[model samples]
Target: MENMLVTRFGHAAVLVETEDARVLLDPGVFSVDEVFELERLDAIVVTHQHPDHLDRSRADALLARNRGALLLADPQTVEQLGAPWRAHRDGDRATFGSTTIAAVGELHAEIAPQLPRVSNVGVLVRSETGPTIFHPGDSYATVPADVDVLALPLSAPWAKVSETIAFAQQVAPAIAFPIHDRTISDAAYDIYWNHVANFGGVADLRRLGQTEATQV
Candidate 1:
């Protein structure tokens, strides 16, 4: 894959552009303003209904701008979002332009036994001209094989360093990068980064700066 680009917009939001298509993932509240400014998107995928991942307040406007883009979300989120949003469940597949998206995983990681679980579907994206990438939204419940790049969630209420490292080992991608990292402070970022670099079992771990586009 040549000229493939992945641009992070803080936390879990990212823009993936290949030679044939452009896709946006998890445009949550923490995502930067530039996300809304984007046009000509092939698809806008939401992992779940969480405000941090869906950004209900601004979603309508974003969709209005990219009227041609497919709005896909988890089953429960589809019910909540209604028209214009379709369900993307485990084993389901969809195509936008030359990019193919396959849904995997089912539920969000257990935050606690008391809190109810919600649907969360991770997506695997493949393009004829780009590397295969996987983004496991809020869960490590399912591990897909033959991934070229992994969007590893670096921090969250339900995530731990051990599980994060183990998840990376299980997927065993050629390269990995951090996401879901709004909670990390400047002082503590290196601690997490170093641990993953030393033990995550991936050959390369690239830390993306906010809004910076990097080739993976």
Candidate 2:
């Protein structure tokens, strides 16, 4: 994201600076200590209604602080936010500042009997670098199958190594990483390593994290 002047702010939150302005994604509430330090924002793109991924407090903070942020979200999320948000559906396309964004659909988890109502969406961020990064919300990791940088789930409820491998194999990104694993055990990381190293045609996994950004 060097050319796009992007930076990671922990969990799924990220800030992208195009030629015109900055855009925030997810902006998890925890990100307040780190990312919310920024004084201004051009817009916000929300993935779903999950608290960790879409904290109302954070948006409210942005509104109170920046006040100029334009919000984009899936329909259900749009309604839930209660703040005026431009709705974005799967396959819908739009641009934020100079950054081009595509909203895509994703499964919340490997099908569950009781939690079908929760909705999720993935984001394909197109930089002048062009489709360099993709965030698969808090999803099952099969969202964007062939982007430059694919961010998949490594440790969340129902997210096993098998599912991650399947997604890596399918997405086949040049470099891939995982998210939603804040409280997971070390075993999950081991699985992620083995799969990316051995799985044929899987993405060349890099495993970027929330720590001060470092290239793996």
Candidate 3:
């Protein structure tokens, strides 16, 4: 099998490339401007409707650039975004070139009891010639089997260090890396990464620099 290459465009946005496919995950507001310049994507996946995870302002242009890419989003996002985006609910699977994407989980993590809950889905992406990676959008509820690389969420209003450690331990991925971290400062990142490194229980924990690609 060929290796899979993953590039982080900041926060939760990632460009995952395999031998036969190139897929972008969560091209959100926090993502770098370079995300819009990417081309030849086999698919664009949005885990939820949150602007931080799906930038509505740049969505049109990005779609225009990758006109052949499949657009997949959570149920509510599909309802909100309308045409061209298909709802990828829990248990639903889609194939893009040689890559297979499976949607898992349903609701975003609770921010507060007063806030309305929105739909969310964690995606599991695998290719016949590459590693299996899991990107858990905003929730740590679904723990898929046989995950090689985990795109772990490092910070959020709805996340805690303890919970982050627990989630990584539960998934037990061979390798893990941080995502959803644009909100915190560099000092805070050091603190959080320290804790996860000590207790996340994964064999390897990688810190991906913005816009840099790493092969697995």
Better of 1 and 2 by lDDT: 1
Q: Against the true structure, what is each candidate's TM-score? A: 0.97, 0.82, 0.97
- lDDT by residue (1-216, candidate 2, tens digit) is 445554667777777566665777887754546666566787788888777777776566566776677778878887866667877778987775556778888445554676675667788877664446777886654456457777666666666667677776777777666566564566556765666568725435555557445332
Scanning candidate 2 in windows of ten residues, the lowest lDDT window is: 207-216
Task: Tell me the spans in candidate 3 whose CA falls farther than 4 Å from its real position.
Answer: none
Q: What is each predicted model's overall lDDT from 0 to 1? A: 0.89, 0.67, 0.91
Query: Each candidate: how many clashes?
Result: 0, 1, 0
Predicted candidate 1 versus true structure: per-residue lDDT over 1-216, tens digit per residue: 555789998889988887767889999998888888889998899998887787888877889889999888999999987988999999999876677889999999999989999999998989866789999999987999889999999988998999999999999999899999888998999999899999999887888877877887
| lDDT score at residue 148, model 2, on the 0-100 scale | 73
Which number leads on lDDT? 3
Score candidate 2 by TM-score against the native. 0.82
Give the local distance difference test score of model 2: 0.67
Poorly placed runs, candidate 1 (over 4 Å): none
Lowest summed lDDT across 10 adjacent residues in model 1 is found at 1-10
Ranking by TM-score: 3, 1, 2
